[model samples]
Target chain A: MRRLHHWPLDPASRAARFALAEKGLDVDLEEARPWLRAEPLFRLNPAGGLPVLEDNGATIAEIGPVLEYLEDAYPGQPLMPRGAVERAEVRRLIGWFDVKYNGEVNAYLLHEKLEKRAQSLGAPDPQAIRDGRDHLRWHLDYLAGLLDERDGLAGPRFTLADIIGAAHLSCADYLGDLPFDEFPAVKTWYSRIKCRPAFRGLLADRLPGLPPAKHYDDLDF
Target chain B: MRRLHHWPLDPASRAARFALAEKGLDVDLEEARPWLRAEPLFRLNPAGGLPVLEDNGATIAEIGPVLEYLEDAYPGQPLMPRGAVERAEVRRLIGWFDVKYNGEVNAYLLHEKLEKRAQSLGAPDPQAIRDGRDHLRWHLDYLAGLLDERDGLAGPRFTLADIIGAAHLSCADYLGDLPFDEFPAVKTWYSRIKCRPAFRGLLADRLPGLPPAKHYDDLDF
Candidate 1:
């Protein structure tokens, strides 16, 4: 049996869930709160980060490894593209969202709005929120430019790049932070990915006490 | 002909350079400072990050994609182990350094010492450097614990995990920041990887004004 420990709204965790579902793998989901740094989570992953996967007695930690493990062990679904060059493009996009986007946008926006509230770490900084919003617009422009070139983030076929990208954007949308209408191309691409069966569990994720935006779950917003 | 645009002291760029050399692939190296964000660099990689690889009409940007592309395209020397589980471990370590370690240690230490000095951003903050040193000790203890069990990181084989790990640690060493005497196991492991041929180029790297630690290139340290 495969068991995954993840937080519902964590973008990395969401990406892992989406990939597992896309691969048609059945997994026992365990909710892990990263802030707690629980003993169980630390034992499985010394790093104490979320989205750790235990499969066939082997445990894989972090989103990068979990996603790569799925591709390596379960080759049936093949979320990665065929060609090496295309695969590089897909990985580049993954890094863009994982590192660049997380640093520029999520670290400010999510940390200030979501994590601060979740951890009861006082009120959010307005200046930080404004900075995050500015960065978000720039990121949306970059995504729109990429979408203009192809149907998906990487290319014609839907890949892990799209899954990871949507995972981040979905979380932002949940907080009512995304300006979807401003970038019509990004909005269109997101709307298509939002409707996927793999994304169902993610859309259903509702953080307790603090609810998502009104149109977050709407298919045609 | 293969060509790599990189910054000498950038940990990610060092990983790419080390990986390329380990695979016995000779490439022309061009220095590209990420802070400059030159148009040529932006043209190849819109992200404008250091360590962009250009080979055979294809340009791969960022350390993650560059390393993965090398693995996918050139499978001869095989830096990655054969098993899926082992591969996951390697990737996990990569993420550990890339995300956790980078965030905890480098973001404070390197950004204050190296980046600020390079960009002429002013004097380094004493508190941030102190915080980085404190966190660095914790990281060293963790690495020491791992070395006590395995001959090399991930397993008996010297894989990409060691390459990436050394890449980060070496940068700290270059700045005379790492306390090798405190963690002998980690030091021994560093010494072993330090003696490799691929490490030669990295040891030779010197910033125009800032010199490496006296023992930075010393194999017997």
Candidate 2:
């Protein structure tokens, strides 16, 4: 059986988990406290990060590769499109959300609200949060614009990009940071994703001290 | 003809350019000042980032997708490997450098040394620079370890991972930020990359007010 080392709350880890679920492949999930720098985990990933996958005798770290690996190894549900150009578009959106959204929005919120150390440096600066909020508005608008034309961010069908994007937004939603009403299209899209069986596991995720938002588990929210 | 909107000194832009050259594709390069956020470039990428590509009526932005597009559309030299598993490894390393390296090292260095506003915020905090230096040392060590086992980062043959990795390191090298001597293996790998014909254009990159390191153009330091 494939074993996945991940943290339930982490967007990247959730992305990997979502992909696995979408493909209908079962994985032995191993929750890892990445920030703690666990011994075997740290040794496996010199960078000491989460979302590592040990599959078929190969140890894969990084969300991008894990998605691609799943798509390649198990090609039934088709997480990515067949055409090269279409694949590129899907991959591009994934990169945009994974890198840009993570950098601008998710990281800021996670550091400020979830991680106390960042607060020790200073209280959660309203200005930084405000900036992140504004930036996320634009990103959500972009997603809405894309969803305006296509079923998914990339194209006509659901792909890894959607899973990854929703995973990040779900994390933000857990913190009560996502303004879903501001983006009606994105909100509707989220509703569809929330109804998926794969997302059921995510809704059950609960962090010790940091409780989720009221609407986080609401399917109709 | 393919057209590329980029800033010569930008590592992401250079990575796209390197991939294009490696594939023997001709691109009409346009110099874009990302900081200015010009209207034309903004239309191409609402984020107003560098390295946007226009090819055959389709516009693609972001380094990872651009590389994937090229590898797919023009498969002559094959910037990526044939096997699905090997390709996964390559993409993972590319993400490591582009996302992880960019977040921890390049972003700090660029914000401190290049962006005047960030520098003016404090006094180019010595501690931040020191932290970046230390972080880069570990990154170099990690790269050295990877190089120790394989001929290249991903596999036997040079892939897009190698090109992108060199692109980031080259940007740091220009600012004299990389300590090549600490990791002999990485230094050797870098020297090999420097000698490539595709790297010639990048070697000539010059940023205003930030001059290249004395040995920037030298194949051997």
Candidate 3:
């Protein structure tokens, strides 16, 4: 069994959890308080980032690596496609969500509305929030376009790209930041992802001091 | 043969170039004035980002995917490692550079100092630049620590992690933004990367308005 140090509220963390569930690997979920600069966690990851996994004793910090490790180390359900080109496409989408989406959406909302100590770093700039919203809208449209072409972001099969995309949206959804009504295709895709057995743990997540939106846990919503 | 729409001075563009070089793939580089919102290119990528690659009529936008596509399509020297765990680590570092480094360093210096159009989007926030510099110093230190343990970022092999890290730093180096004196290990590692044949194209890059530092081209520097 692996030990995962993560925060249920964090999209990247949830993505890692989702990957683990897909692999059918049971992991001990230890909710991490990253801002406090927790001792062992800090030592494990000097960057003090989340979704740190302790397998045996070696700790994997970044979400990309953690997912790759799971898919590679325990290849059961085939989360990623076998073809090199297909794998590249999958990795590309994963990177898109992890980097581009995180920058344009998650970081702004998570730091602004969620973290109490964000003011110390710098008061959440309204322009950044506005910019984030605009960027997300464009990204959602891009996802819709991609979905229109293929069953999933990468191809016909559900892969890490879907997991990453859903994870970011779920975080936004928790804060009521997602405008699902604007993106019907994306909304329907989210609904499909929400119904997955792997997503049960994520939907059940309840972050302290930050309650999810009304439709966050509602499968039918 | 793939076609790359790129700006010589762009770090992301340089990264894509380096990835292609590593794969020994011949990519026809088309210098694009993205800011001008050029026809066809702008229409293909409405985001107006750089290093967009066109291969077999399919347009691939974004550095992460471009690199992955190259590796998948042309597996010469293996820019990424063989094992899934190793590949994940490489991808993780790539993300670190593309996102964390981009946020903490490139977004500040490249957009502010080089582009100068950032103020039009939002007044050039001095605090953000200061924050970026501080964050980059910490990241450099972290990179040095990582280099202290291994030959390359992931392990002994020279992976895409090295290429991505070097790509960003090379851009900063060109602008004389990096304080190499502070992190000797990073400086030494960079020196090693600078000697690579693949890096020659990056060294030869010249932006229209932004001139490279005096030491930019001197490999001995």
DockQ scores for all the models shown? 0.81, 0.60, 0.43
lDDT against true structure, model 2? 0.85
Q: What TM-score, computed on C-alpha atoms, does each candidate reach?
A: 0.94, 0.88, 0.85
TM-score of chain A of each: 0.97, 0.94, 0.92
All candidates' lDDT scores? 0.91, 0.85, 0.81
Better of 1 and 2 by DockQ: 1
lDDT of 1 by residue, B172-208 (tens): 9999999999999999999999999989999999888
Model 3: residues >4 Å from true position, as ranges? A107-113, A117-140, A175-183, A208-215, B36-43, B117-136, B208-211
Best by TM-score: 1
What are the runs in model 1 whose C-alpha is more than 4 Å off?
none
- The candidate with the higher DockQ, 1 or 3, is 1
lDDT of 2 at A220: 82
Off by over 4 Å in 2: A117-135, A208-215, B108-131, B206-211
How do the residues A1-221 of candidate 1 rate in per-residue lDDT, one tens digit apiece? 79999988889999999999999999999988899877989999988987899999999998878888999999998999988899999989988888889989999999999899889999999999999999999999999999999999999999999989999999899999999989999999999988998888888888888899999999888
Clashes by residue pair, model 3: none
- Poorest stretch of ten by lDDT in candidate 1 chain B: B151-160
TM-score of model number 2, chain B: 0.93
User: Tens-digit lDDT track for model 3 on B1-221?
Assistant: 57999887677888899888877778898988677776877666645678788887777777877777778777778888887667877877877887778877887877767666523565567876677678789889989989999989778889888988999899888878788888988988888889899889898877766678988888777
